[model samples]
Target: MLNNIGLPGLLLIAVVVLVLFGRGKISSLMGEVGKGITAFKKGVSDGSKDDEDEDKTLADGTAARDVTPEAETDQKKV
Candidate 1:
């Protein structure tokens, strides 16, 4: 379907976009999308770290809800 449309189809889409949004608004929209992607990645990484900390605490039978630098040494002190 896409291959059949080809360059002329793409140009028509671009023209419609330009007519509807103009260049500056489109650039700003793209920038926001990039920021959203970055923030989404950060959130995913943060969630993974939280999960890892949960697993670590569960495996060790610790009462701490979250891991911290002090928590790392708590086990050593015991």
Candidate 2:
């Protein structure tokens, strides 16, 4: 379906974008977009590591401690 647009249509769209934004602004915008994508990927990777750490902590089985109702009330008082 997209093959119908061809080179001419793509060039027209590029020209329109260039006219609207100018070359420097478009280049800066693309650079910012690339940086944003990189940051997002890094964040996802870091978050996945955090998740794995949590999973590993949970797997150790000693992390889950039962809190008594009295302990909860005492902590809340603080």
Best by TM-score: 2
The lowest-lDDT stretch of 10 consecutive residues in candidate 1 is: 59-68
lDDT of each structure?
0.88, 0.89
lDDT by residue for model 2 (3-71), tens: 799889999999999999899999999999999999999999999999877865666565755557987
Q: What's the true lDDT of residue 26 in model 2?
A: 95
| Candidate 1 per-residue C-alpha lDDT over 1-78 given as tens digits, one digit per residue, 9 for 90 to 100 | 666898889999999999999999999999999999999999999999999888667666865564468977898899
Model 2, runs deviating above 4 Å: 1-3, 58-78
User: Residue 9 in candidate 2 has what lDDT?
Assistant: 97
RMSD of each: 10.5, 9.1
- Poorest 10 consecutive residues of model 2 by lDDT? 58-67
lDDT, model 2 = 0.89
Candidate 1, RMSD to the unseen true structure: 10.5
Q: At residue 68, what lDDT does model 1 achieve?
A: 65
